[model samples]
Target: MAIHSPSLVELHAFLAVARVGSFRGAAEALHVTQAAVSRAVQRLEEQLGVDVFERSGAGVRLTPQGTALRRRTEKHVAALEAAALALRRPTERLRLRISVAPSFGTLWLLPRLPDFHAHHPEVALEFRQYHHEENFQREDVDLWIALKAQAHQRWPRQVAAEYLVGREIVAVCAPQRARGVASADQLLAQPLLYHSNYPDNWALWAEAAGSALPAQWRGTGFDLVLNLVEAARAGMGFAVVQRCMVEDDVAAGRLAMPVAACASTGRGYYLCRRRSLGAHPAVERFVDWLRLQCAGDRGA
Candidate 1:
C-alpha cells in the first residue's frame, strides 16, 4: 500500500523545498515563512513515510526517493501553474465581433457605430470586413451580420435570426461614367464591375432596364461592393450595389445612378449567431437595438 496520497498544496511545498534545498530558501521562493516551509516539507515526508532529503555539513542533498518524487511533482506543479494562469484571465467582456460585407461596414455600420456606442458604452463593437458569403467560424466571432441568404446557408439551423434590411440594388457610377448610359447597349458598352458571387447582377439590371447589355459589359471583376463602389466613385467603372449600404456615399455626391432602373435582388442583411451566444447581455441588447432600428427603417 502507498504511504500517503499527496494533496496539491503539499506537492507545491515539496517541489519548492526540493528545488531550493533549504527551508529558508524555499520559504523565500514561495513567499512564505521558514516555519511554513518546514511544516509543508514535514507533512510531505510524513505522508510518504520516507526521507526525501539528506542534511549534512551546511547543505542538503536529495535522497533517491526525493529525486523520483521531484520528477513526478514537477510535472504536476507545471500543470497546476498553467491551469492557474489560464484561470487568471478575464473570460468575459462586453464586446461584439461582427463580420460584414466590406461595403456595408464602410457605408453603413461605420457611420452608425457612434449611436450604438453612445447608448451602450460598456459594449465594444468590433467590425470585420469579411466577404458576404465567407464562413465566420475561422475567426473568434460572437455574432455576424451578412446578406441574409449567405448567413442562412453558412450557419447552423439553430441560430436565431432576423432580417435587418431589404436594400435596393442599382447600378451606380461617377457622373462622367453615367453620362452616356441611355440604352442598355450603351450602358453595357461602359466597363461593368461584376461581383464574383453574383455574376448575373449586371444582366438582371440590364433586363430591368429593358435592353440586353452589350456583349462586353462584363469588363472587370470585383470581390466586394466597396471595391466596386470605390472604382465607380473614381470613374474607373460602374457596378450595381445595394442602395441602403451606399446611401450615405450617394447623398455625399460621390456616386450617381448609372441607370434609371433598380432591381429587387430578393436579398437582405440578417443578424445571426448561435442561440447560446444570445444569452450574453451585450449580444442580446445589440440584437434588440438592431431590430428596433430595422423596424424604424422605411425600406424594411
Candidate 2:
C-alpha cells in the first residue's frame, strides 16, 4: 500500500493525546474542544490504518504502534514549535563589532562612544580590547584600531587602513613633581616611568627638546600606557606619554607637563577594517566620527 502524509494538525493532536493519555486532557492543553481533539486523532488513525489509542478504565493508553509513532512525531513537533517561536521573535539589530588596543580603547575611544550612540541610536557598537595585530579570519571583529606602523606593515590584503592621528609625546608628572623641575635634564634626574613597548619615547622627546640624557638613564617600565599615566599622576614617577592621552588630566590638574616641549614620533593611530565592509554604512559613520575627533584633537 502507498504511504500518505499525515496533516500537521492531526499529528499535533495525536502527540498531545499520547502524552496526556486522554482526548479531554489533550483538548485542554491545545485549547480546543474534546470532540475536535478526538476527530483529529481518529483521522490520523484511519490514515495509518492502525488503532493508535485504546480506551480503558484508567482512561486511555497508546498501542505499541502508537508509541513508536509518537516518538517520531515528538521530534517533528518540537522542530515546528522552535521554528514558530523563531519567526515570532523580534528582528535582531545590526551590530558593529570593533577590536582595538586596550590603551586606545580606554583613553580615547571609550570617552567618545556615547556621542556616537547619541547621533546614531539605531546602530549598536561593541568594542573588544586587544593588544595584538588584527586577524582578518576572525569573523567576530568588523574593525580595528592599530598603530600606523603596524597597520601599514601587517595589515592583510583583505583589509584596508586609514591614518587617524599622529601623537605628540610630552613629559608629564604630578603638580608637586613638576614644581621644582625646570629643565629636561632636571626632570630626567628624577624617577622616570616608561611604557615597556615604547622604550625610546623618552629618548625621542629629549632629542626634540634639545636636551641630552644622562648616561645610564633608566626608569620604571609598565606594559600599558594607561598604567604609566596613572603612575605619573600618583607621583610614582615622571612619564613621557602622548599628549592626547593626558589632555583631560592636564586640564584637571591631575598631571602637568614638566617641560613645555612636545615631540612628534611620526607614528600614529590608524582605523582598519575588512575591505568587504569598507562601504558599510555603520563603518562609515564611525570612521567619519573618528576623523572629526582626530581633527578636533589637532585643532586643540
Candidate 3:
C-alpha cells in the first residue's frame, strides 16, 4: 500500500484538537468554524487509516496512534514556527519587542528610552505595557520587565530571569502634606492612599517604622501605582510607594517623604526573556543597557 502524506493544514488541525481536547476549542484557536475543524480532522484520520481521537461524553481524547503521531510532529511544527518568525524579520536592523509592567514603563523606562535609542542606533525597539499576570508565551514579546517576589522563582519554563532592582517602600505625600508630619505616627494619621495590588504597603511600612496606623485612617485605593503617585502628588493623601518609582517626583518637589523609613519586602523587578532568545544580540544589548540603568540609579 502507498503511504499518504497529510498537508500542513490537516496536521495543524489535528494538533490543535489534540492539545485543546475539543473540536470547538480547536476551531476557536484556528479561527475557523467547528465544521471546518471536524472535516480537517476527519480527512487526516482517513489518510492515516486510524482513529485519532476517541469521542466520549466528556470530550475528545487522543488515541494511542494520535499520541504517537503528536510526539513525532510536534518538533516539525515548532521548526515551521521558527522558520516563519525568521521570514517575518527580513530587515537589516535588529528589532526587539519588549513587554513591561505599566507603571515601570510609564514612570521609569519611558523617561530613559531616548538614551537607549541614542546608544543603539541600529536597533528598533517596540514596547508594550502589560500587567504582571499576562502570559507572555502567547504574545510576540521578546523580553519582559516586571516585579516578582524572588528573582529566581516563579518563571514560566520557556523563560529565564535576573534581578533588575529591589523596591523600597516609602511613605510619600505632597510637600504641603508633609509639613505637619514630624514622625511616622503623625504620617499615618493622614488619609492613606494605596496600590490595589499591594494593599499592605502602608501597613508594612508602619510596622517597619514601629508606628501604628490610626484607627480613623481614611484610604483610597488605585489599581495602578502610577495613579497612586499622582494622587499623592496632588496632596490627596499620603501614599506608600516604591521609592524607585517616585524618585523623580520626590526630586522635583512633587512628592515628599514624611518619615525617614522604608521597608524592603524582598520583592524586586526582574528582566525576563524566552530561554531560546537569551543569546540573541538585540536581547543581550538591551539587557546590558538595563544593567547600566540600574547601576546609574544606585549611583544617583
Candidate 4:
C-alpha cells in the first residue's frame, strides 16, 4: 500500500502536541483552540494508520511510531520554521557591523545615534572602536568610519572610501583663559595642549592666523582627542581640535573657541566598505543617511 503524505499543518500540530504532551498545552503553544489541535492530531493519526500517541488521564505519551517520526522529522521541522521566520522578518538579515574611529564615535556619532535609530529602526547595528594598524580584511567589520588624511589614501584591496566630513581645526580654551588674550599673537604665549596624532595642528592653525609657533614651543600631548579636550576645558592650556570634537562642549559652555582663525589639514573622516558588499540594502540605506548628515555638517 502507498503511504499517505501528511500536510505541514498536521505535522506542526502533531509536533506541538508531542512536545507539550497535551492537547490543551499544544493549543496554548500554537495559539490555537484546543479543539483545532485535537482535530489536526486526529486527522494526522487517521492518515498514518497508527496510534502515534498514547493518551492517559494525566496527559499523553508518544507511542513507538510517534517516537520514530519525531526522531526523523525534528531537525527538518526546525529548519522549515526558521525559513518561515526569515521570510516573515526580512530585516533580520540586514545586520551591519561598523568600525568607528574612537574620537568620531564618542564625540559625534554617538550623540546622533538616537536620530539614526528613529529613522531606520529595522536595520540592526553593531559598533566597535577602530584600532590603529587594524587589518580591515581580517576584522569582522562590515563598514568603517575611518580617519583619512587625503582622498587618495590607500585602503585594503577591494575596500572603497567615501569622504564624510573635513577635519576643520578650531583653537579653543576655557572662557576665563580667553579673557586675557586679545590676539592670536598673545594666545601663542600661553600653554598649548596637543593631540599626539596631529603634531602639526598648532603650526597649521598658527599659519592660518598669520603667525607661527616658536621652534621650542611644546606642551602636554594626549593620544585621545577626548582627553585633550578635557585638558583644555580644565584650563590646562589652549588646544587645537577638529570642530566636531568640541561642538557639544562649546554649546554647553564647557569649552570655548578663542580664535577666529580656522585651518584645514586636508584630512577628514571616511566611510569605508568592501566594494563587493556595497549592494547590500542596509549598507545603501545607512550610507545615504550619513551623506545627508555630512551635507548638513559641510553647510555649517
Candidate 5:
C-alpha cells in the first residue's frame, strides 16, 4: 500500500491531543472546538491506517502504534512549527544604533555583549563613541548611554532617559603605592593622577574621607579616565575614577583601593532613547535586557 502524507493541521491536532490526553483540552489549547480536534485526529489515524488513540469516557491514551508514531514525529512537527513561526515573524533584521561613552563601552559594556547577542541574535547593534558635542537631532542614533550630572536635566525633544548606574568615585592605585598608605593623609602624600575632564575628583574623594584637598597638590593630569587609570596602574600615582570603570581591574588586583574612601560623583549613567523609536521591538528588547544586566551587576 502507498503511504499518504498527513496535513500539518492534522499532525498538530494529534500532537496536542497526545500531549494533553484530551480532545477538549487540545481544542482549548489550539483555540478550536472539541469536535474539530476529534475530526482532525480521526482523519490523521484514517490516513495512517492505524488507531492512534484509545478513547474512553475518562479521557484518551495513545496506543502502542500511536506511541511509536508520536515518538518518531514529535520533533519533526515541532521543527516545522518553529519554521512557520519564523516565517510569521519580521523577516528583516532589526538595526539598533546606540551611542555610548567611550570608556564605559570599552571597559564595561563590550565584555557583556556576547550575553546580549546570545539573547537577541536578531538585533544588529551599531555603536558610536559618545562625545560632548553629539548632535542627536541630526544623528540616526536610536539610543545613547552617557553620564549625566544630577542637576543636568536638559534633554533633547522626543528623548526619554532611564538611569542605569550611579557614579561612585573610588581612589585606587598600584599595590606598591598602597603599601605605606595607611591613612588618608599618607595616601594623599603620594602623587595623584587627575582626569582633566573631572579634575575635582580628588577633592571629592578627600571630602568623603573627611580630609580636605591640600592648597597645592602634585600629579600628572590626563584628558581621559582610561589614561589616568593606566598611569595609576603603572605606579605613577593614585587615581580617583568611577567604580564601574575600573571594577574588573580592582577585582583582578591590578589596582587597589588604599584609603577605603568612595564618594558619589552626583552623576549617573543614563540610557536615553528617541521617543519615536521607543515602541520598536528591538529597542524594547535591548532596553529590558540592559536594565536586567545593570540590576544584576548592582546586586553583585
Candidate 6:
C-alpha cells in the first residue's frame, strides 16, 4: 500500500501551531504572519486527510487525530532537524576511523597520536587494531597503518599504500642483558629471542652482523614484538626490534642498543585504504599531516 508523507515545512508548521495553541501565537514564534501559519496548517491537514485544528474566537483546539499525529511527528521532526544540521557541518568537523597492526599501534602509533590530534584539532581520530592483516573490504575504515619489512611482500593490497616508517630494527634489551650481544662470538654463544612472525630474525641479524650463529641458537617464540621486547627488558634473551618502537625505553635507560647488528629488513610501515577517495578535503589534509610527521623518520 502507498503511504503519504508530509513535507518538512508543513510538519514543522503543524508542530509549532499545535504547541502554541493559536495561529497568531505560532506565527509570532515562527516569525511568519498568522495568515501564513494558517495556510501551512491548512496544507498539513489536507496532506493528512483530516482537520487538525478548530479555530474559535479566542484560541485553537486540536482534533483527536491531530493530538496523536503531533505526538509522533514531534519526535520525527526533531530527528530530521538534527540530521540536516549534520549535513550542513564541515567534513573536518567529523571523526576519522583508522585501523592498524596491534604491535605497531601499541608501541608506536598511539604514542605519537597526540601530536596528530594537536595538529589537526578538527579531525578526531578513532583507532582500531588487529593482530594480523585482514580484508578491509568488510570494514568501513578510512585508513590502515600496516607494519612490515622493506621487502615484505605479504601486506594489504586493496588500499593505496604509502610508506609510514623506516626498516631499521635495532638489537634491544635491558642495560644488563645488552652485554652478551657485544660481539659476534658472544651473540652466537648467547640465547637469542625470536618473534613468531619473523622466524628468520636471528639468522638475518647474525648475517648482518657477520656472525655465524647456528639456526639452533634461536629461543622461545613470542608472536608479538611488544611481548618479545617486554621479555627482553625483563632480562630475557635479546631480540632485534624497531628503533622507533623502543626509543622511549632506550632513552629512559631501560633498554639499550649495545650493538646495531641488524638488516635493512626490506619491510616498513604502509598507510593503506580501500580505494582512492579522490583527494577529499579531509583525506588530503590527513595524508599531508601524516607525511609531515613521518618525513622526519624518512630523513633518518
Q: Which candidate is the best by lDDT?
A: 4
Preferred candidate (TM-score higher): 3 or 4: 4
- Sort by lDDT, best first: 4, 5, 3, 2, 6, 1
lDDT (Cα, tens digit) per residue for candidate 5, span 92-171: 33677889887778878998899999999988898866777654664667789977844455766555667787578888
lDDT of 4 by residue, 1-300 (tens): 976778887898899999989998886556566788889989989998998899989889999999998888878988987676556545545787899988788888888888888999988998866777756674478889988855356877556667787578888999888887878889889999998878899999999999999899988899988789889989998999888778778889988776788898888888877644523556667878899888887777
- What would the C-alpha RMSD of candidate 6 be, to one decimal place? 18.8
TM-score of each: 0.59, 0.65, 0.66, 0.67, 0.66, 0.64
Off by over 4 Å in 5: 1-93
Q: Candidates' lDDT values, in order?
A: 0.71, 0.80, 0.81, 0.82, 0.81, 0.73
User: Model 3 — which ten-residue stretch has the worst lDDT?
Assistant: 84-93
- lDDT string for model 6 (117-227, tens) is 787787767776653646666455777787654384754434557677747676777888766466866755766777887877677777888877674564878988889
Clashes of each: 0, 0, 0, 0, 0, 9
On the 0 to 100 scale, the lDDT of residue 280 in model 6 is: 38
Looking at model 3, residue 187 earns an lDDT score of 82
Cand. 5 TM to true fold: 0.66
Backbone clashes (count) for model 5: 0
Alpha-carbon error at 296 in model 6, in Å?
Answer: 1.8
Candidate 4 lowest-lDDT run of ten: 274-283
lDDT (Cα) of model 4: 0.82
User: lDDT by residue for model 3 over 1-300, one digit each (tens)?
Assistant: 866788888999899999899998887556566787899999999989999999999999999999999999978987886676556553522778888888888898899889998999877888876766855574578888977844245777555667776567888999998896899878887889998777777778999999877656669999988899899989899988877888888888888986889898667778876644422557767878999998877565
